[model samples]
Target: MKKEFAVIGLGRFGGSICRALAEEGMEVMAIDVDEDRVNEFSMIASHAVVGDTTDESVIKSLGIRNFDHVIVAIGDNIQASILTTLILKELGVNKITVKAQNDYHEKVLRKIGADHVVHPERDMGRRIAHNISSNNVLDYLELSDEHSIVEIVANEKLSGHTLIDLDIRAKYGINIVAIKRRNDIIVSPLAHEEIQTNDILIVIGADVDIVRFEKKVMG
Candidate 1:
């Protein structure tokens, strides 16, 4: 079954998510206070409505609680975003995802019952900084505040070692979840799987442990 989602904002982040969800064949209800933004997404979304998200009656009237997921993406206006999130929670929305502008915003969202909070701008900046900082580090994703998943090229030092020999989980508290070589991808690689020089390792672990693993193994 196609999951139903409501994106409550028409700015870049919200609009992009609405478009992507619609493109993936999901039902997306796009909401915005701006009539122009609503009109722009009418053709792209399952439904588009112009309404003030901070109003509880507006949300209830639209039956927003029925959506499988609701995203509060109101930009710039922190008060509106927080109030909307609180209203959605009170209305019993199954899942609530909020776009937080900063750490303080994220904390507030979490306190108000947002199931998930994203800092898209900050995360993008971090990715860009990581890419510019190291040629070996291809990508970085924060699974949690302390945990992360990273993609790094296998250096010469790791060429012949198998996962069992390295004992990454025991020594570094990290797991080599997968390996990507050119066009090939090996998922949940076996303990005996040997590492080839230049192969990309997709690893997951605590951020500090990942750093240690990268320095000790990939360095």
Candidate 2:
């Protein structure tokens, strides 16, 4: 079955989610308090309406609880965001994801039963900083506060070494999950698979272990 999504807030983040969901052929309802913003998404979303989501009657009228997932993306106004999420939870929405302004906002949202909370700006900043700090780190994804998946470029130091020879999992407590060579990708690469210079290694491990592996092996 196609999952239905409702996005409350028509700012950049919410609008982007609407567009991506629409592109993926999902049914999406876009809502905003501003008529202009709602009108802008009229052709992009399955339905676009101008309404104050914080008002219980407004949300009930739209049948928002029917959506499989709801995203509270209200910008700047932390109070409104919390209120909207609370309303969604009260209405028995199955899953709710909220964009949090900061740590405090996130804590409040969690307490109010938000299924997921995201700090987009802060996360993007971290990704950019990681890329800037390391030449070998092609990309970084935070799986959690202490765990991450990183794409590291294999340098001369790591070339010709097999997984067994390096003892990656045993030594650094990290796993080389995949190897990307040219246009091809090898998932769950075997222990005997040899590393080639410039090969992109997709690794997963705790942050400390990943950092140690990068410095001792890739660096």
Name the best candidate (by lDDT). 2
- Evaluated against the true structure, the overall lDDT of model 2 is 0.95
Off by over 4 Å in 1: none
Please provide TM-scores, in order, for all candidate models, with all chains considered together: 0.95, 0.97
Error of 2 at 163 (Å): 0.7
Q: Please name the candidate that would achieve the greatest TM-score relative to the true structure.
A: 2
> Which consecutive 10 residues in model 1 have the weakest lDDT in total?
210-219
Q: Candidate 2 lDDT, tens digit per residue, 68-174? A: 99999999999999999999999999999999999999999999999999999999999999899999999999998999999999999999999999999999999
